[model samples]
Target: MRIVVVGGGMAGTIFANNLARRLSSELKAGKARITMLSASDKHIYQPGWLYVALGRMTPDELEREEASLLEPEIAFFVDPVQSFRLGESHVVTRSGKVHEYDLLVIATGSRPVPEDVPGLKENSVHCYSAEDALKLHDRLQAFTGGRILVTVGLPHKCPMIPLEITFTMHDFIRDRGLIDKTEFYYTYPIGRAHSLENVATWASGEFAKLGVRQETFFNLKEVDGAKGCVRSEEGSEVKYDLLVAVPPHRGEAVIEENKLGPNGWIPTDRYSLHMQGDHGEKVIVLGDTTNLPISKAGSTAHFEAEVAAENAAAMVKTGRAARSYDGKVFCFIEAGKDRATYAMFTYQKPPEPRAPNAAMHAFKMAYNQLYWASVRGLM
Candidate 1:
């Protein structure tokens, strides 16, 4: 049996490593094979970007060679897929090579589309990518004082980032002794401060204590950079000296070009993690590539990858799937520089975040270093 995994982000890497371990006996007997193909040779810890924006971590600290984290039994390639020929059970790469597989796992992640909003790309600084984080770091460093605005768009990766960034930046500015001189303004697209009700409630109280102004139902429409103000789709306008935005997101372009799902997201079974169509049995979708209504956090990808890997390995060895994904996700929320909290929930339950503590913050910091081990399937 041949299993091909696409995209080397957290989801793909974890799935490949887990499956290789499960099929070790079959691999030694020449009965099964696991191969991973990715666009880049470097695997980055994406969550660390928030810390990068705050000057807590350097970009080099978050990077590792993709092959270094994989098991020796798994084959690795740096060729990116250009087109998906699911009808023929094959994929064409940018190098004009065709690869066939018995089981295909698509974990291609999402992309931030800041340009989707008029003038937002030109005026905002975001930490979605390494370069963007570095740019934000520089901008924050040079900032003296004034209003700092945080604007959020819907369906972004790491649902807690909008709140996390705001809280961390408040601490950052306070450390610089500019907290009093700077006014903090935040906007969300929903009726509340966050998509999750409990998180929103927690964030609202925290904002009140910090004296941060907030506006809800403020969908992004346009930014007038010259006037230093942003307009909302609902005809609301807000001014800012520095704009920090969590832009809207979409799945990879290959998925969109292949028409796998609208906006590059593949229609996937929420429970089985399989593609939702005739060939669904042979095609599994994980991570940001799946059109599941869940938080697009690294933990979401981590849990889904576990289920996909287990089911695929079971099918290869015993001719049947073994388990189903339960929509489990765990995320650490940095309430401030020295304190943190966490949210753990499943499909049937909502997250109940506890009060912030230094111990949880320390654990979150430790987990940052342990992420490499986690990706290698050693956790």
Candidate 2:
């Protein structure tokens, strides 16, 4: 059986590694093969970008060679897929190489599209990319005082980052003795501060305690850079000295170009993790590429990858799927520089976040390093 995994982000890496382990015997016997295709040779720890913006981590510390993370049994390539011909059970890469597979895993991940909001790209500082994170770092260092507005867009990766960055920024400024001079203004599109009711409630209280002002029902309409203010879809205008935004996200461009699904998100079965519709059986969708109503987070992808890998391996061994994804998601919320909390939830249960503590923060810090092992399917 040929298993072709597309996109070498967290989802793709973990899934390929796990599948390789499960099919080890078959692989040795030449009965099964696992292949991974990625755009870059470097595997990035994306969560570290948030820390990079705060000068807590460096870009070099967040990246490793992609090939080193995969198992030797799994074939790895740096060529990115340009198009997916699901009907033909194959994908064509930028190098014009076509890979045919009996089973396909789509984990292409998501991209932040700040340009979707008019003037947002030019007017705000974001940590979605390495360059942007460093830019934010410089902006944070030179910032002395004034309004620091944090705006959030929908369907972003890492659901806790908006809150995490806000909390951490407060601590960062406070350490610099600029807390008194800075006013934090946070805005969310929904009626609440977060999508999860319990999380929103917890974060609202935290924000209030930190003296951060919040505006709900606020959507990004446009930014008036000259006036140094942002307009909301709800007809509200707010000014800022520094704008930190968590821009909206969409699945990878390859997914969009192939017309797999709207906005680059493939319609996927929430439980089965399979692509919805006729090609469902052969194609499994994982991570940010899936149109599941869950956080586009590493934990979400990690959980989905486990299920997809297991099911795929089981299908090859037993001619049937062995499991279903229960929408399990876990995230560590950095309450401040030294304290953190975590939220763990499944489809049937909502996450009730605990109070922030130093131990949780330490664990999160440790996980940052251990992520390498985790992606290797060792944990």
Candidate 3:
């Protein structure tokens, strides 16, 4: 049997590594073949972008070579996927190579597209990527006693990242003796600061206490960098000296290019995390590719990887039903340079901080170290 895994991002790498180990005996016996495809050999630890922006960690700490993380028997390909020929059970790469597979796992993650929103491309430096985070770091370093706005575009990844920026700036500016002069403003599009009601209440209260004005129902409409301002759908305007904007995100172009998805996202089952198509257990999808309402976070992808692997294995072995994902998501956001708040929940329930303390902060710090181990299938 031949299997092809596309994209070397979180879900793809985790699934591929685990699957390779699972089928290790088969690989040695010439009963199974697994090939991993990535757009680049660089596998970036995405969550580290936040730390990089805050100057807590360097970019070098989060990057790894894709080939180093996989089993020796697995074939690795460094080529961009042009399209997925689902009906033919093959994937075509940019180099005009075709990879046929008995099973295909899709995990090419989403990217922030500030250009999608008018004027945003000119005004925003985001924490969504290493390059973007480094740009933000430079902007923050030069800032001296001016209004800073941490705002979001709709449905962006990591709902808590913008909030983290709001708090991080408080610490960074305070340390530089500029907190008294620099003002903080954070805006959320909907009626609350976050999706979970309890989490929102706690965060908004904290924002108020920190002098970070939190505004709700202020969906971003446009931005003007030269003007140093942003306009919202609610007819509200906020001026800023610098903007850390969480731009809108969309699934990778390959999803839309193959017509395997609508709006650049593959329609997926909420519970099973399977691609909604007639592929008959041949195609499985997870992470940013799915249309689930959960936060598009590393933790969500971490958990979803397990669900997808178990289901894919069951489908392969017994042609049985796929297992269900409870949508359990855990996130720890840095409330301050030293303090953090954590939440855990599923689709039906909202998350509440069990104990938003320093211990959880320690866990998150350790998790970053373990994250690399996870990529190597050590966990």
lDDT string, candidate 3, 103-219, tens digits: 888888898988988889888889888888999888888888888888789778887887778887789889989899999988888899877678788888888888888889888
Clashes of each: 0, 0, 0
Ranking by lDDT: 1, 2, 3
lDDT for each of the candidates? 0.94, 0.93, 0.83
Q: Candidate 2: misplaced stretches above 4 Å?
A: none
Better-scoring candidate (lDDT), 2 or 3: 2
What lDDT tens digits, residue by residue, belong to model 1 across residues 1-379? 9888999999999999999999999998999988889999999999999999999999999999999999999999999999888888988888998889899999999999999899999999999999999999999999999999999876799998999999999999999999999999999998999887888998999999999999999999999999999999999999999999999999999899888999888999999999999788889999999999998999999999998989988898788999889999999999996899999999998888898999999999999999999999888
**Poorly placed runs, candidate 1 (over 4 Å):** none
Global CA lDDT computed for model 2: 0.93
Model 3 gets an lDDT of 0.83
RMSD of each: 0.8, 0.9, 1.5
